[model samples]
Target: MKKSITILFCVLLSIPSFAQKTEIIVIGNIHQPVPNYNSDTILTILKSIKPDFLLQEIDSSFFNDDFTFKNPPKENEGLASVQYIHNNPKTKMRPFDFEGRNEYRKINGFNPTEGLAIKLLDSLYKKNKLTKSEAAIYKKYNDLLEPLKIAASKDAKSFNNSSNDKICEERQYYQYHKLLSIMQERSEFSNTYYTKANGEKISYLKGFQLASEFWDLRNQTMAKNILHIAEENPGKRIVVLTGFMHRYFIVRELQKQTENNTNIIIREFYN
Candidate 1:
C-alpha cells in the first residue's frame, strides 16, 4: 500500500510538467516612432504580455558587461525592452540576433548588390525595356507593400497583425525569390558586375544570392536561440521583440520546431 501511495504521489508531482506549455509571443515592432506607434506603444505591449523572458532582436556582442547596449542605435525596440526589464525586474531580457552579422555584411558587401539591382530595374522601367511579366511582378509587389506602408504611417496595431505578416511574406517572395528568378532569366542583370571593397568583381546575381543566404542564416540562428530558451524554461512565457520585416521568418522557423513536438505555443500580441 505504501509503494502504491508513493507511485501516485510521484505521478501527481509530474502532472504540472505535462500540463504546462511554453507560451511564446512574437511581436512585430518598429525601430523608430511612426505616427501612432512610438516607444510608449512598445512598452505598453511588453507590459500587457508580462513575459517571463523577452527575446530582443539585438546581438549579444552589442551588450556591455552591465547588460546595456555598448553602442545603442538612435531608437529601436531593444531600448523599449530595456525599459520593460527595468520595471519588471523578474523578467529576463536576452539578445537573439546573429552574432558577427555586421562583420558578415561588411566583408560580403551585401548592400551593393541590392542597390545595383534596383538601379538596373529602374533603368529598365525608364527605358520601357522591362518585359510585361517583369513589370507586372514589380507592380504587384509594390501594391502589396502599399497597405503596409499606409498602416505603418498611421495605425500601429494594423501594421503588426497577421494580415500584415502575410503581406510581408508575399513581399519577400516577390522581392527575393521572384526578383532573383527574373534577374537570372536575363543575362543583362545576371552578368552585370559590381566591384567589391576588396577589389573583387562579383556578378550581381551572385552577390544577391549571398545576401539572401545571410538573411536566412541570421533568422535561423535567432529562431534556434528562441527555441533553446523555450525548451529550457518549459512553461514560461517568452516574448520575441523583432522588426516587422523579420517577424515572418522567425515565426515560420518556430512553427517548424512545433511540428517536431516542441512544447511551444506561438501567439501574437493581440491574441
Candidate 2:
C-alpha cells in the first residue's frame, strides 16, 4: 500500500512540470484584406494552448487608431476585431503593438516600419557594394520615398531646427554615386524589375535588399523593445502579430536568448 501511495505522489508532482513546459509555437500565413484566423487550422492548435501574449505585425497605432472593426465573418474575427473577445478575462489576452510611425512614433521612429528598408539598403550603397542595376533600383526607391523625405525633413527642421541624424545618415548614403558595383550579395536582391527612363532594365534589387536589411536587424534592435515588454510580464502568455516575413525571424531570435527560456508561440496570417 505504501509503494502505491509513493507512486501516486510522484505522478502528482510531475503533472505541474508537464504543464509548465515553455512552448515556442510558430505560425505562418499570407496577408488577407479580411483576416482568416478563425477558420485557420491553427485555431484548434492555438486553442489547445492558450498563450499569455499575442504578438502582431502591426504597429501599436491600432490600439488608438479608432478604426472601426470591419471583420469578414462573425466566426473568424480576432481579439482586436471581436469586441467581446478583447474584453474577456478568461482568455487574458492583451494587445502589444510594435513601435512605428503610425503610433508610438516617439519611441519607435516611423510608421509602416517598411520605411527602414530604404535606410538599410542605403547603408549598403555607401559601402560601394551597390551595382548599376541596383543604383537604378535605388532611384525608383527614392522616387517612391521623395514625398516622405520632404515631409520628414520638414518635420525635423521644425522640431529641432535640423534634420534628424538618422534621416541625414540615410540621405548621405543613398545620394547618387558615380560608379555602381553589381554583386549578388544577399543585400542586393531584386524585388521588381522595370526599365528606367533611359530604357535600361532596373535590377529591382531595392525591394529584396530592403527586406534583407529588415531581417538583418529584426533580431538586433527592431524587436528589442518588444522583448523588454515580454520579459517584464513574466509568466504572462503573449501573441505578437507582425508582417508574415518577420514572424519567422522574430521567433528564431527569441529562442536564442539565454537569460530566459521564453516559450514563443508564432501564428502567421495572410490578409
Candidate 3:
C-alpha cells in the first residue's frame, strides 16, 4: 500500500496543471452613434460584461499617463468606455491599437477611399471605362453584398450581432482578397489607375493590395496586445471593443491563440 501511494504521488507531480482559462468577448462597435447602437448601447454592454480589463481600439498615444483620453477619443466605443470606467473604477481600460497608427496612415496617405474599391469599380463601369465583363463582375459582387449592408444599417443592434460580423468578414475578404484577384484575372482592372486620397496616382491593384496588407497587420497587432493582456491576467474576463470592420480580423487572430494556449476563449457579445 505504501509503495502504491508513492507511485501515485509521483505520477500526480509529473502531470502539468493548467491555469483557468481567460474569457474574452470581442464586441463589434460602430464608430459613429447610430439610432439604437450609440454610446449608451455600448455602455450597457460594458456594464453587462463587467470585464476586468476593457481592451479598446484606441492608439496608445491617445491616452494620458493615467489612461484618460488626451483629447477625447472620437469613436463611440471610446466614449462609452470612458463612462464605464467612471462607473466601474476597478475595471481597467487599455489601448490596443497599432502603435504609430496615425503617423503610418499619414505617411502612407491612407484614406478611407482605399476601402471603397468596389464603389470605384462601379463608377468606372458607369463612366464606360470598364468592359462589359468587368461591369458584370462588379454588378454581381454589389448585388450580393447590398442586402447585407442594408440589413446591417437598419439598426445598430443588428449591425453588431454575429450575423453582421460574418457579413463584414465576407465583405472584407472579397473586397481585399478575392475581388481584386478576380478583376486582375479577367484583365479588367490591370489598366486602371486610381488617385489615392493624397493625390498620388497608382495602379488600382497595388493600392488595394497595400491597403489590405496594412489592415491585416493592424488587426494582428491588436490581437497580439489582447493576448498579452489575457496571459498576464489569467482567469480574468477581457472585453475588446473595436469597429465592426475589425471584429472579424481580431477575433480570428485571437482564435488562433486559443489553439496553442488552451487558456483563452473567444466569445461574441450576444454569446
Candidate 4:
C-alpha cells in the first residue's frame, strides 16, 4: 500500500496543470507587398505552428474587404499573410487592434489624430497659411524619409523559420524607429505656432501629440485585449501579426502580465 501511494503521488506530480498553458507568438512585419514573400510562405509556416487563434493590426470592428481598396499597401505582406491564415477553414480569426482613426478621434475629444498634422499643414500651405520656408523644411524631411521607408518595405523576410522574436525585434528596432525619429524631427510644425488666415493661432504640435497618444493608447489597448483573450480562451496558441514597430512594446507588456490560472509561454514562431 505504501509503494502504491508513492507511485500514485509521483504520477500526480507529473500530470500537467489543469489551468492550461497558453503559447503566444508575436511576429513583426513590413507593411509593403514585396513579391518575393507570398501567401504560400506564410501559409506553410502557419500550418506548422498551428495557432488556435490569429490576431491582426486591424480595427476590432472593421468588417471584410472594405478599406484595403482605399489604401495603397492594401494587399501588402502583413494583410496578405493574415488573409491566407484567416481564409483557411481551420484557423480561427480574432480581432486584436483597436478601431483605426476613430480610436484616436474618440480619445482626443474634438481633435483629429489620423495623420492630421500632415494634412492640416499641407492644407494650410495650399491656402497660403504657412510660409514658404516652413513648407520647404517639411518637404525636405519627407524627402529624406523616402529611403528609410523603402528599406523597411523591403524587409519582409526578416522573420522566418529559424529566427525568434528577438531577431525580428532587433531588426526593426533600427529601421522603424529611425523613421519615427526623422518624422518627429521634421515636424517643425510641432514647435512653430502659426496663425491661420482667419487669425486663429494653431500649433501642429497639438496634432502630433494627439497622434502620438493615439498610437501609445492603441498599444496599451492591444495588450489588454491579449490578456482578455488569455482569460477567455485558456491554453490557446495565439499569433499576433502586427507592424514591426509594435513588437518590442507588446512583448514587454506581455512579459509584465502574470496570471494565476493560466500559464503563458511566449515565443517566436519556428517551423
Candidate with the greatest TM-score versus the true structure: 1
* Colliding pairs, model 4: none
Best by lDDT: 1
Ranking of all candidate structures by their TM-score, best first: 1, 3, 4, 2
lDDT of 1 at 191: 76
Residue 241's lDDT within candidate 1 is 84
Candidate 3 structure quality by residue, lDDT tens digits, 158-271: 665667767878777766776676556644355556665667866555656677788789999999998998888878889988887788788888888778777678876667
lDDT of 1 by residue, 1-271 (tens): 9999999888877875576788999888778876678778888888888899888787779778766668754565876777887888888877888887777776787667776886787677678887999888777866887877876776557767777889888888888787777777878876788887889877788777777778789999999999988888888999988888889889999999888665679987878
Regions more than 4 Å wrong, model 1: 1-19, 260-262
Instruction: In angstroms, give how far residue 50 of model 3 lies from its true place.
Output: 0.7
Model-by-model lDDT, in order? 0.81, 0.42, 0.75, 0.59
lDDT of 2 by residue, 5-63 (tens): 99988887677433343333334333343332332433543454465554444444444
TM-score of candidate 1 to 2 decimals? 0.88
Residue 60, candidate 2: Cα error in Å is 1.6
Model 2 Cα shift for residue 144 (angstroms): 27
What are the root-mean-square deviations of the candidates from the true structure over C-alphas?
2.7, 15.3, 4.7, 7.7
